[model samples]
Target: MKTKLVLNFNPEASNLPITHNLIAEYGLLVNILRAEIDEIGGKMVIEVSGDDDSTNKGVEYLKKAGVGVRPFKEGVRRNDEICTHCGVCVSICPTSALILDHETRKVTFVEEKCVACGVCIDACPPRAMEILI
Candidate 1:
């Protein structure tokens, strides 16, 4: 079985000290999927994959560190009407979770490869991709 996890960082919870401690403690192999800093806030998306135990452990570690998480299902499509298909998200996706289908030419989102970093959402100019619970 495969599980897709998504972590939504709250603007109020942006604390590097706690983030660093959690990463160090849990050995979270985080790869920066996307990062942006502006007047609004700082955002970063990361993808993490491992065995079931490791993945669950990572979730637990994040929860303890006060991060928000949601499990995403595979084959779940967001509002395509709002999707722009600009390919900006495809280029910024760190784990290759979002892809452009060669046959259909539509954006394909694969949950199995998602690290829950939420970068595609930020990269999305139209804000179409949604975090499904």
Candidate 2:
């Protein structure tokens, strides 16, 4: 099974090798989708793939280690009515979740690629991007 999570790390938790431990100790495939962290505190979105039991245990371990974890089904959504296809979000998206169709000259939101990092939410002029979780 695969699970996507948003993790909030405090100052002390930031120093820990949480990702490494999740992979090495829990035997899971860890993919860091988006991360903006500093010595203080920050947030990260990660996707982990493993068996149901391992995934659950790994999440439990994160909580025990002082990491705030929130699981979500989907990340971001775009309102087609509001989006102007300005391409501002297309350039700023780290994951290329927002794509500019050259032929249509329109911007499209590919939800599957979104990590809910929220960069496009602010960059969007129309305020079309909404965070689901």
Candidate 3:
């Protein structure tokens, strides 16, 4: 099973090796999509892959560790009517969620890979990419 999680970490929790424990102890594969940390706290968008039981257990463990866990559904929304398909977002997207289709010469958005980092929101020339957290 694959799950996207948005984690909010408090200052105290920031010092913990949470990601390491999620992998080593929980037996899950962790892919960090987006991360931001500061003196006060931080936020991270991570993709975890494991069996159903392990994934659930990992989520439970996160909650127990005082980390705010939220399910990430839609990351970036593409407004077709507004999008020019100029491929502006293709280069800026870290996850390659936005791609330029060679056959059609159009830009394609793969929502499954999107991490909702909000980079495309400002880069889209037509104002097509909207971030929904």
Candidate 4:
């Protein structure tokens, strides 16, 4: 099974080799989708693939290590009604999930490619983008 998680790190947790331990100690594949952590602390988005037991244990290990872990239930959602097709989000999307259709001059959201990074949510002028998790 594959699971997506959002990790909140404090200064102490930031210093730890969390991802290394998650892979080496827990026997899981860790793919970091987005990471903003620095010396102080920040958030990270990661996807882990493994058996259910391993995944659960990895989550427990993270929590025990003083890192906050939350399941990323869903990616970003766009409110079509509120969207102006202004294409503000298109330029900022890291995964190219939001695209501007040149012919129609409208923005298109390709949900499959989104990593739920929340960049588009902030850039949207109409406040049409939101993260479901």
TM-score list, all predictions: 0.46, 0.77, 0.85, 0.75
Steric overlap count per candidate: 3, 0, 0, 0
Question: For residue 100, what is the lDDT in candidate 1?
Answer: 90
What lDDT is reached at residue 11 by model 1? 62
CA lDDT of 21 in candidate 4?
96
Candidate 3 Cα deviation (angstroms), residue 102: 4.3
lDDT of 3 by residue, 7-66 (tens): 999998888898999999999999998888999898889999999999999999999999
Report the lDDT tens digits of candidate 4 across residue range 43-76.
8889999999999999999999999999875668
lDDT minimum window of 10 residues, candidate 1: 69-78
Candidate 1 lDDT, 1-133, residue by residue in tens: 2344445556655654534643576555655544545554455555555566766887777776666766544323457899976677888877788899878878887766765555666667888877532
| Candidate 4 minimal-lDDT segment of 10 residues | 34-43
Please give, for residues 22-131, the per-residue lDDT of candidate 2 as tens digits.
Answer: 99999999998878878689788899999999999999999999999998668788888898888998888888988999999988788878888888888888898898
Least well predicted 10-residue stretch by lDDT in candidate 2:
71-80
Off by over 4 Å in 3: 102-104
lDDT of each: 0.62, 0.88, 0.90, 0.88
Sequence-dependent TM-score of model 3: 0.85
Give me the runs in candidate 1 sitting further than 4 Å from their true place. 1-4, 17-23, 36-44, 72-133
* Model 4 alpha-carbon drift over 4 Å, by segment: 38-40, 86-92, 99-112, 121-127, 130-133
Q: How far does residue 130 in candidate 4 sit from its true spot (Å)?
A: 4.3
